[model samples]
Target: MGTALGTRSASAVIGVEQSLPSDVVVDISGALTNLVADVFALYLKTKNFHWHMSGPHFRDYHLLLDEQADQVFAMVDAVAERCRKIGGQTIRSVGEVARRQRLKDSDVQELSPGAMLSELRADNVRLREFMLHAHALCERHEDVASASALENWIDEAEKRIWFLFECSRN
Candidate 1:
């Protein structure tokens, strides 16, 4: 007798024979999951800063954070989708995100506008570094699709970093 999906045995699972080796997919997805977590964390932080921003530059800073938050949030879905596309498990919950994320959470107290900008800038730099490392791993595994996605993400992060740095200057 055959299994439900025409498999002769019960051992075979769907998507088990992905184009990329399972190990490579697992490794790439792990990296992408971590990136997703960080992006989510940053998204929340940017929103926090946006909501709490004040002072003479309130409008400018608030709008900047809002736009940045949107950009960060946009990446989250792509990262998770890419992980699933490669036949690997994605982050399942907020706890999973916290466990995988490398970004630090901000304090409940509102930070100064400059302080917020600086912290976000630093986090973006870190995210960019992680993306570069992931890109290299993708290349090593010949995962061109993942590598291409990372390239676009890296460019976006770099622009964010540049804008944040400019905003931070006197």
Candidate 2:
């Protein structure tokens, strides 16, 4: 058992066969778990913004967030599975996700459409940064598969940020 990300419960170390060292597996698993948590957090926030979206651009903004939310959600399973494939267990509960998540949650009753887009854009940028950090870790550990996976995710995050930035602009 080892600490999974920053969460309290010790993650059950699995016996998945892989060439990487145990420390590398633990590090990557913790990093990927954090990424998964952030992805889930961002997914829900995107949906929240989509559901509550209003104003002159309601149709367009709503559709955009809905699409982005789907894209964001598409990331979860791949990342979680990557953690497991690399010889560490993935997240098992919503509570685990909440404890490991690094992204901020929104609870505002009202927000301008611009504000929502801006917030999501910022979050995507941060997500990209987080992926890059994990990528760097993979690089340092010579974990080619994990690094390659993070590259695709980083690209997706860039696309999301681009869309949100363009949409939020006046």
Best-matching candidate per lDDT: 2
Candidate 2, overall lDDT? 0.88
- Model 1's number of clashes is 0
Per-candidate TM-score against the hidden true structure:
0.89, 0.89
Q: Which stretches in model 1 have alpha-carbon errors above 4 Å?
A: 1-18
**Candidate 1: TM-score?**
0.89
lDDT of 2 at 160: 90
Lowest summed lDDT window (length 10), candidate 2: 1-10
Q: Per-residue lDDT of 28-96 in model 1, one digit per residue for the tens?
A: 889999999999999998898898899988999889889999999999999888888878888899999
- Tell me the lDDT of model 1 at 153: 94
Model 1 lDDT-worst window of ten = 5-14
Total backbone clashes of candidate 2, pairs 3 or more residues apart or in separate chains: 0
Across residues 1-170, which tens digit of lDDT does each residue of candidate 2 receive?
33232322244343353356677789998999999999999999999999999999999999999999999999999999899887887889999989999999999999999999999999999999999999999888766778999999999999999998999888
After the best TM-score superposition of candidate 1, give how far the Cα of residue 168 lies from its true spot, in angstroms.
0.7
- In angstroms, give how far residue 41 of model 1 lies from its true place: 0.5
